[model samples]
Target: MNPLSIERLKVFPPVSNLDPSIYGPQDSALKEEQIICHLNGMSVQQAIEENKLFILDYHDVYLPFLDRINAHPTKKAYATRTIFVLTDMGSLKPIAIELSLPEKNRNGPPKCVVTPPVDATTCWLWQLGKAHVCSNDAGAHQLIHHWLRTHACLEPFIIAAHRQLSVMHPIYKLLHCHMRYTMDVNAQGRQLLLNAGGIIESHFFTAACSMEVSASVYQNWWRFDMESLPADLIRRGMAVSDATEPHGLKLLIEDYPYATDGLLIWSAIEQLVQAYVHYYYPEANIIESDSELNAWYHESINIGHADIRHASWWLKLSTPNNLISILTTIIWLASAHHAAVNFGMYPYGWYFPVRPPFMRRLVPNERDPDYTTFLADPEGYFLASLPCLDQMLHYISVLDILSTHSADEEYLGDRKDLSAWAGDPEIVEALYKFSMEMKKIGKEIEKRNGDPNLRNRCGAGISPYELLLPSSGPGVTCRGVPNSVSI
Candidate 1:
């Protein structure tokens, strides 16, 4: 730690008397005991009673010829009585009186008491002392001391500034409102979809009835009444029991209203994708491309459909470029569908647009108005959105596969300099085992979907699009059921 300076003064007295001329005139004035007592604001009796006086001595040497010729010979050494006293406030004040004596050898010069400066505000000083005690090293002690002193002085002002900014910031209220709404919807959705006795039956019903009535009846029966079926058929049906149902056009349109629901989902997905790309690969051209896409979409109202179609194109692309884009799209769409089911369908401009009627209604004191609206058969919408959730999970699985493959490829590339046999055998074996296991799993998944072309990327590698196929299960069938009612 850096040295600290404090208010202090030092006094040096001369050795034994030699007419006071050789020693200097200033030394003459320091010889009187009364002066020392007067300087410390104490009488001789008070100083003696307090026992604050000390006699210090040190040997000294002068020129031999000058000392021998002197009438009053200078002694080789001398002693002085040093007096120390403190003010009522604990400030150190001292005085010294030279008691000239002829001495041959004595102790060294008297030690001076270095006083530390008193702090006006003792709280910060106390904090600094605490910091010093807690610090493990000299550097840490100095840093803590500096930080405490610096920040403690500004703490009040900083808190006041933060409070002012919170109120003045335009996005603060909007973000808080949106966050509250999202959390509420999430709680309601989890209760409806994930609870044991909530929507499980409805979910299963929708999954089971998603396919053609005839095929579904047969497939559903083999699993639902497993004991009545033949052993071979029952075994086969058991293998497909975990299948997921596909999201049909009717269901998509019903759950995702084009203007309000679809647009919000689309915008959210775009924002999320841009945020991901900008954070991870800021120097990449993808940011510029996304910005261009956004500009094209906002240029005119007529191009809105084109913008959606353009963004959707990445969903079909079997390249790494579409990884985050497609995943975010599916996630936002699924979340929007979930929200719409739990919260009634509301207009697009409700809470989002600046100066909207809904914005005025979004106060901490009031309940969300859209949540109170009456809707016919809200449970059916929740059931319909369940398939969208499945689709979202499928996309997430594809993202996992892509991420794993990319990491594996990068790892292998990094070790390209090493011979295959020279590399860590365990790591190589682990990679090979993982690939083989994934292939086996993929084959089973294909069997459940009854699709030979699933995950087959033009004989190159597995395609992420294969996740779009319904997963294998009793609830899934080889064919889709026609919509009984118009969407």
Candidate 2:
């Protein structure tokens, strides 16, 4: 594959009023003005057609912006929104709760929120950082660096009130626009919100997965599952504590036989398992046997993971049995009967909101392990690659297409013979050869003849010299096959 030619995911193109051409001087204020001008021309009819609006201010654009940043993250691409949303007025306290987006972490400022006494009447403006102050309604003329900061969790409440007045999604039941939201103002504000997509929020899910994985490894367990397996220790070549001075996952790969290949194969299996659980079982906690799987998942927190993923965990973790199969029938209910009448389409149910039905059933147990006791202890946490989540995105996109009325075309051409040769035949041959040749290799992992030497050898590092060695099999593998095929 040509690296330069392969276009990585560019899901949401940052726009200034739907036009990327408006970027000028690399300064934010000029760009905001361009966006506001662009929105002033928008209409409700226009919004329904495009199905996207620029976010205005801090309150309403929370998770939607998070989704955008997660799609394609970079520091430059992420910060542009706060530069506009937190614009200050009158040297008063800033509106947002974050004091400042610290330059320390590339992922985000910190995992938190802000809350205060803000109503529709409160006239506040942005100060430097994530703070806000009272304003006289004139534009932010200058900057103030003295404003204090708060956490991320609390900021949404006041902003939530403000979003109450913005453009309402017909399907979003709670966001009923105030009468002040004229046909004019709503159109303008929504466009600003759409343009502000990549900014205003952090990629909290990516950060959460990284943190949880690290914390789990640091704790010498996978907290999401409460299993009692020595598999974790054996796989890592270390115990729960580092008193033995044994190696962990890093050493296992470097020194163990087939460590790299086994890990890669295991990694792919993990993805397949996750997908199976999420799609087929739909309510099962498939990874719960890992002992600490749930702990690192941080199941109590509302944000930082996909709703479908979180809800699936909640369903399995809470019930552990009963009525699981029945829930899948409502997956495409379009918000239910109450939702349709309330929001004028279908009611945006509680499952999609802050207080989903599963929250009450969960009894959170955030047990922080003391990793310092481990010998030769690692100073930080474990971080797993999130290729699974990326793959899930592809799955959901395909699901969305299939769910729509427009997906009826035959995915293949009318004539199969014409399309058969389109793909590279050499790649096809490589796959066929690997599948056939790797057959005998699978048996060794399952081999157990009660011989310590054979057990150790089977589990030990694979010899690099023996990768292409010819082996015998009774027509189940590449038995007595020639090694003429170059990999």
Candidate 3:
């Protein structure tokens, strides 16, 4: 439940030793006592100094809509914040979670910080609290993390590419594979997945407010520069730049499968793009004089994502280095970034308790009637708290479809038309080199999955993280990086 799936789970900004301004500060209800006990001999401040503390905070984003959400007869939710400590083993372990209702006056602090029950007799209540948090995480995962970042944000780039670049353009050919089927898939999603009273509303905890929540995130957190893997890791305090480290950055969690493997794929793409760009635009003047290239970049920034088009952070494409970096980030987003978030749904979430999409009941207090029902039959109450039988089936079916690959799926580096670039033997050779690197990455991923030292992927009962494995057969194999957002 780190940034890949729960993208809003940022490193606790106030305590971060590096780039504390990456995310703005918020009022923290989490106390040091609740966290220090689980820090494995390290003090809470020491962990923060070492960039080990992280938070999945949903307080401000969801608090504004909780009343409207809870008013729905059958749906309920809480604005939750989960605190985690990075273990020595390089995996996140949850230390505490705080759930809250709206402040009575709308301007004051939450009436009280409602933490998970601690008494031994109230373990069921604790479990129920976690379930509510999972519901919040799952909803945000699907709507903002997956949809808004990858599918919605990438559309403008695709549109601008088609309008500006011709099929004969080298940049167009380079991106064609990654652009396949995206428009069609996005169109279908709009009509089904994101439509009002559609699958998202019916299955996710956000219910009627699903798109509203996504818009809020886009307005507040989405940025084109940070969409790149390296920038994203740095912004989240998951890694820090170091000249001596691999990829010139050291990951905070050494066993983070996503960062380890993603860096490999990301570097490979960068190398291939650098080679292609250098071959075409040998000098800065060549890049500056390319009308089609300039047109594509300007349209993408000025017309497609015009809201931040004037922002100083947007990279100017006057040099080959700049173009290469931009193209690499875009391809990465369409393939690996989308793959990391989209394909893991079934493997991690199919077991309903692990990630319930919606909660049917709120955590009950001692005075509440539902408290009696929970105590009498905790298991039954837990089951009843989840989406009903029909809803569960509906959610599972959607996950299965999203996770599955088609028989003819084209994975990253599986360029069937390498011959299309045959006119330029250098470009074809670069493509061949990229294809080979992807195959090697696949083998390396398998090797890591078998290495006992990486407990996150190799431990008993842990499914190896293969969502970025770069290849898979047809079916819900929970592996593969398709060339585009074909799902």
Candidate 4:
């Protein structure tokens, strides 16, 4: 295990200390392109969602000097943080969209549009990912890399963001505390580090099904105590046998509906767990990454559960969907298991526990009742939690969901309340837009491969019309069951 050191988390060139001109986006065309998109919209969310970004799973993207977030720093000034952004543009729709293809016969100037202009015509689901920064760059990198090596974080893309409000890291303060050197250096470098952290904490881009970045760290950590898990907990099923199913499709359509009745929370967490494993594992994997986690689907995969891969995922269902289902299932399992195994039942999202000096010595310490305790609720907690703001829903809701959390706090929601300091509309927009560029490589791949065959698995058999346009022929139903749910 790598030691936790302040040196490992420091930023280099101290853009805060040095000049912004020093690190130009000239060579970083992708970065440059992202900057342009960022300047266009009112909010980061609107800009990215408008773009419709789709990321290619194989491509490895990182900061210029970053080799690995988990690797020990070779540089004297450790760069502990980095940010990620996602845009909805340049994804599957890019393939689906009609564009003038390069004519085989014509060698002249082709009139194909390189990219679409920013406008209303885009997928709503393709919105921006929050700006994310990784302070435990090394630890996080290591953890995710480890999971990925074992075939996790793949089926679903990994997502995270920096805190809402950025601030100086402990390492930064330590380095500049004495200030024998100019204060300028500390200030600038600190700002960069803080911003980077904010970007990471903003991993709003994590596929909706796979919220891996720590958005729910408190809840998850609390939920991870193995003792909390009921031994008789039904190992697998959409929901408990006694749970009542929702009444109508309207409820589901309005809310993100699930195929399984009571499986909403269950399915969600299971998917995230699979993502967690995939995230920590190494890529260039022929089986896991390439095969969509075929190695471990049905043989009873578990989140944070260290075990060898199994071929059972394939046996559970057909090809791709089987892969998708198993991967989705794993994330939910990991998260849900958090409630049972961890110290707290529901991931104490904002309610953090003390980190014991020694991992082996970590024993549960009951919350002190002698001192004033804080409850993340509609009551008891601050109206705004600051003693100076609005009502109950604002504070409690923030803890309950993403919209509220991002609105109130999210940045340093991990260790400390950093959101107040990290909040920056400009940065958030940039990150969301950045996610768009992340998908460039993937879009190019589909362009090369062209359209996937429209298979009629249930034996509608040979729809020649798939090759035809909507106006030209009949539109076909999607593959498999009219509607299906994963375990």
User: Which candidate wins on lDDT?
Assistant: 3
Error of 2 at 454 (Å): 52
Better of 2 and 3 by lDDT: 3
lDDT of 2 by residue, 1-487 (tens): 0000011111122222222232222212222233333333544234223422322222111221333323443211122232111111101111222211222323343222222334421211111112111110000100000000001111222233334322222101111111112233224423431123411112122222222222223233222221111233243322233345322234221222233223323332233223323432344454344333233224322333223233332334332232222121111011111111111101111111211111101010122232222112221111111123443344334323312211121110011122232344542343344334344433443342222343323434421212112232222121111211100
Worst 10 residues of 1 by lDDT: 356-365
The C-alpha lDDT values of all candidates are: 0.26, 0.23, 0.82, 0.23
Candidate 4 residues lying further than 4 Å off, grouped into runs, are 1-233, 236-262, 265-324, 327-487
Estimate the TM-score of every prediction. Answer: 0.17, 0.16, 0.92, 0.18
Write the residue-wise lDDT of candidate 3 on 168-225 in tens digits: 8989989999999999999999999999999999888888999999988887778888
What does candidate 1's lDDT look like per residue over 1-487, in tens digits?
Answer: 1111111122333333333354433232243353343436665455444533322221111211212212211111122233334343322344432222222212222211211224522332222222211111111111221111111211222233233335323212211212222233335634653344333212222112112222222222212112111121223221122225221111111111112123322333344444444443455354344433334223311232222233322232233344345333323322322222111112111121111110011101013243223133333322321234443344334323311211112110122322332334543443354334334434543453343332221124322222212122221122111100000
Predicted structure 2: lDDT: 0.23
Ranked by lDDT, top first = 3, 1, 2, 4
Query: Candidate 4's residue-wise lDDT over 1-487, tens digit each?
Result: 1111111101111122212253232121122243344333434344334432222111112222222221222111111112122323211222111111122212121111122335422221011100011212322332232222112322211210011111243211111111111233224423532234332222211212112332222222212211111111221111123334442111211111111211333332233333433333323242334332332232133322323223232234344433334443333322222111111111222221111000111001123241133222312321111112232234223324311111111110011222422544443333334234323322432232243321211123322211101011111211111000110
Q: Which pairs, if any, clash in model 3?
A: none
Predicted model with the maximum TM-score: 3
Given candidate 4, what's the lDDT at residue 115? 28
**Runs in model 1 lying further than 4 Å from the true structure:** 1-257, 282-320, 345-487
Off by over 4 Å in 2: 1-45, 56-271, 275-487
Root-mean-square deviation per candidate: 38.7, 28.5, 3.7, 29.3
Model 4 global lDDT (CA atoms, 0 to 1): 0.23
